[model samples]
Target: MIPIAKPYLTAEDAQAAYDTILTGWITQGPRVQEFEEKFAAYTGAKYAVAVSNCTTALHLSMIVAGIGEGDEVICPSMSYIATANSIKYVGATPVFAEVNQEYNLDPTDVEKRINSNTKAILLVHQIGMPADIDAIKKICSRYNLKLIEDAACAVGSAYKGQKIGSHSELVCFSFHPRKIISTGDGGMITTSRKDYYDRLRLLRQHGMSINDRVRHNSKKVIFEDHIEVGYNYRMTDIQASVGIKQLEKLDWIVTERRKIANKYHEALKNIEGIRLPLERERYFSNYQSYSIYLEKSFPINRNRFMQELLDNEIATRRGIMNSHRETAYKHLEDKVNLPVSEKLQDRSVLLPLYVPMIEEDVKFIIDTILKLTQLKTV
Candidate 1:
């Protein structure tokens, strides 16, 4: 069966891994530093901190931003649970907010959620489609709130002529195999602020004044100190080696995926009771995930539709998630109604858009969906 998502790895990627292993410095050493530099240069970020994964990246973003206990961070519930969990990692409350037609955090709803205790807005570029960054940035500036971007699936995505990482103050990215880029399981935090860049660098490596690589490279014996309590969230040279290669292919991957996305749009646009993902003007999505929304008027239910796709040998997945409905965030749930977010979680399906899918694969998936939607076609 066709997969909903898969990593686009080449023999070169495997070779990079092997080369790093041969170097005998597989920890967060030269390769990790090199990957950080390349990623920062690519994203226009002044510095990029490589980490274990996106969740840890988010956690670090929160810590460096001064989000802590008694503070509330506004984020859309229609996202990966990691988005909300990151806020909690800093002992900050995550207040659920609604999303717009673009499936991004709605600025209007976010404004209403902002109380005296609100510290930041964790905006997500959900599934590689950028959120309304301008509107949200305006809100942050007006209220003096921190703006952190959960850019997990948006490695190669852009917004308003700028890349997603360069647009936000603190942007967290994922390199999970399921994401646009694969580092096996790695993440990066991009920021233009020198202060944040320094703090994150110190915090990610156990808050040590001197890093292991620096100590080992010293001609004479050197001492180190733990400046503050920090987590072991460093990315390995092995993962960074693979990430470097993945980064090289990012632009081409995005171009090819956009072509596939266009095909899906063309094939599915005419179907009744369906809502398609939108690319806002100047917001270039990488289509990290191609999710389809079955309107209430659609003939089939979401589960049954997915089942039918599986029966037809096409694998599909549900939309991101609704954190409020999950047991993990039960205490965070509130009376505030997130209608758009709820509807999106319940009605959306993620179709296979992995690299290497042929035109025939795209057509087959489209034809099946059209049939499921009860549209007439040959």
Candidate 2:
């Protein structure tokens, strides 16, 4: 069956992992540092800290941003649960906000939700589509609020002329298999601030006063101290080895994904009651997931459509979920009224999209979707 998303990995990536493992430095050491430096250079960030996963990256970002108990972080509910969970990890309340047509946080709605308790705006570049950064930054500037970016699916995406991670102060990214790049499962946080960089490095490795690499390379024996309480969130050298290779092929992978997305746009744009994803002017997306919004006038409901695709050997998934509607966040169900977020979650469908997909499979999937979505008329 055609999968919803897949990483563009190669034999070289495997070889990198194998080579790194053979070196006996299998933990967070030189390889992790190299990956961090390369990633920071790629995204134009002054520094980057590798972590176990995006959730840990977000947790660290929240901590460095000074979000804590009684503080409210404004974020879109239409995102992975981890987005909201990170705020809670640092003892901050997540104030769910609405999203615009681009599926990113709506700055206008964000402003309306702001109160004296609001501390920061956690903006997500949903599905690699860059949000209105300038617009959101303006709002943050006006209110003296901090802006942290959830760029899990936006590693290669650009907002205006700069990359997604480079545009924000504290941007977190994922290297999950479902993303354009893969390190089995890992994450990174990019920041320009030296203080944030130093603290993040310390926090990811149990708040040690000196990192492992520093001590290992030193000629004299040195003792370390736990400066503060921190989590074991460091990314392994095994993952970093793979990540370094994956990062090298990221631009090519994004190009291939965009090609597949363009084919989908061309084939499905004529269909009524189907709203395709959009890339606004100067906003470059990696097209991590190609989701189509099904309007009420659509020929079939989202569930049935996905089932049909599954039957046809083409896997599909529901759109980005609303964390507020989940059992874990049931308390927020009655407190928020996000019509757009709810509608998009229920009606949108994610089509199969991956790099290096065969032409025959791509055509077959497109043909099946077109046939299934044929407009009905008198």
Per-residue lDDT of model 1, residues 1-378, tens digit only? 888888999999999999999989999999999999999999988889999999999999999999999999999998899999999888988999999888898899999988999999999999999899999999999999999999998988998888889987799999998999999899999998999999998999989999989999999999999999988999999999999999999999999999999999988887887788999789899999998898878888888889989999999999778998899977656765888888898899898998878988899998898788773222
lDDT of 1 at 108: 90
Model-by-model lDDT, in order? 0.91, 0.93
How displaced is residue 85 in candidate 2, in Å? Answer: 0.2
Mark the regions of model 1 whose C-alpha exceeds 4 Å error after superposition: 332-334, 375-378
lDDT tens digits by residue: candidate 2, 1-378: 888877788899999999999999999999999999999999999999999999999999999999999999999999999999999999999999999888999888999998999999999999999999888899989999999999999999998899878887899999989998999999999999999999999999999998888999999999999999999999999999999999899999999999999999999998988999999889999999999999888888888888889999899989899999999999999999999999999999988999889999999998998887773532
Per-model TM-score on C-alpha atoms: 0.97, 0.98
Q: Count the backbone clashes (under 3 Å) in each candidate.
A: 0, 0
